[model samples]
Target: MMSRRQIALAAFISPLLLSTSASFGADIYPSRPIKIIVPIAAGGANDATARALALDLQKKLGVPVIIDNRPGGNFVIGTGAAASAPPDGYTLGWALSAALSLNPLLYDSLPYKPNDVEYIAAISKSYQVIAVPGNAKANTLKEWIAEVKKSDGPAAIGVSSFGGTVHLMAEDLGDRAGFRVEPVVFRGEAPASVDLAAGQLPAMSGILANLLEYHRVGRVKILAISSESRLPLIPDVPTFIELGYPISAVYWNGVFAPKGTPKSIVARLSEAIREIVETPEFRARLAAIPDVNYINGSSDVMKALVKADQDYYGRIITKRKISLKN
Candidate 1:
């Protein structure tokens, strides 16, 4: 029903409008608030990291940032929520080593697959540690292993969660150290740490950041840490490499978005986080914690790192024949 002149104008403007729409969509990503999903309960390391990142991101990106804790199903609950979110710039997820690298290999089924999410940037890397009660008779890793040998049964080694990074680290370190450790799974690190500190549990293994406070308070004794080099925060503590075990394995935390999100959006998000991580304030905060390893890069680099890490963990799981039953 349009006249000739009106029809001509509409057709010309439609192409220009389409081009502008695409440009605006990509350029002004995250125009509103962004949500970051943490697949662990609040108060845990993962949750804390997410909150810290959210604070900085909100300030730099000039938009409100919100954190949603979805802790359950061994991290599957919150992770699944992230995987299923719309592939826009709005919903971001925290990818832990457990949910991203270990889950697909350790479990028979999962609510989401590795392909469901895309990596944005690396937040922090941490190594695991083996600790015992402060009052334990054995003071060193060697003495502890010798004492376990003299015992009738294997002493339980508490891991924060089943099939988590620490669970695998404990088992793997035990193998390398020529000892038998029966892993005891806990719902989270705080409870296991508390019980270990109170002497209810004999031994516990977890990321150094989680146990360093307990060590500082004399609630627990950190005998050995699993890292290639000694952490600067605890120069007195020896690493697995230093103890002749060469059992250094680390856990990484990164940011993620649902798959199929625009590369422009992902790149913007990655740059924002990378800037935050490089700031002196960020490094200072990490230094306050124990043995935090910082890794930063572009979105493409992070993606490549994820693929390589996935394969590495997958190989380890296969070689160890690690199953959920263990």
Candidate 2:
């Protein structure tokens, strides 16, 4: 019963209507809950940061943001899960520089590839610190280096993992200061702190946030930090650079989604995360943990950061002949 002109107009408008509907559909992202996979246990600065972000993100996105902790294998298990997830923007990964940069350099094979995930945004960077037992004789970096140099054999220093940021810094310290360094690997920083507090371990290298409490309570003494300049959290501690050492090792945390995720979703999440990171509330939260302030970098900035860490650490690894292989 329709005229030819009417049929033609209907055909023309139907496609445009469908296209507009699809565009609207694409815009309705995160209608359901989103899960962020954290590659560590449910404690410490990394977990706390992820949980805080999820809380704020839930309020911002109008949907639940859940954290899935998959801690083990130096972040391989969780990172692999995130990398293999569907590119629908529902699953994301909370990662550190170790998983993205150092793992590739240290290992011959990895469960996840660098290209497996797309960088979303950087959250924060934590500087490493060298701490000794609370009752250790050496109270300063100058004295500590002399003490280690005089030790009979390689001094044992606790580390979270071989080739980790702290491990590399410890190795560099030994190489420059004329002492044989032997690393005692632990599952994480907590156990290392335990050993350090009990006087079982001579010294350990860990993030400032984790060691701040121990240092405050007189359980351990932080000799030197790895930041370029001194941090306000512990003003008395001098940086390795200030202590006449060229060691500056800091690790960062960021968010990422599996590759092939829609740019729209990436942009949306990046904007939300970056906004949350810049707020005073969030800044205060991180400051409480005493982490080096929030880093405001989206995808491109994250990419550059990863690459810079890779390049710098790669040189150190190659120069020192560091290897995780047994």
TM-scores, in order shown?
Answer: 0.90, 0.91
Clashes of each: 0, 0
Q: Which pairs of residues collide in model 2?
A: none
Clashing pairs in 1: none
Encode model 2's per-residue lDDT on 1-326: one tens digit a residue: 99999999999999999999878867998889999999998988888888888999999999999999998888888888998899989999997889898888888888787777989999988899999999999999999888888879987999998888888888878888888779899989999999999899999988888788889899999999988998877888999999899888878988999999999999999999999998888888877776756887888888888888888789878978887751
Across residues 273-320, which tens digit of lDDT does each residue of candidate 1 receive? Answer: 999999998777666655666787666666665676667566657766
TM-score of 2: 0.91
Task: Give the Å shift of residue 27 in candidate 2.
Answer: 0.8
Q: Which regions in candidate 1 have their CA more than 4 angstroms from the true location?
A: 4-12, 304-312
The lDDT of model 2 is 0.88
Best by TM-score: 2
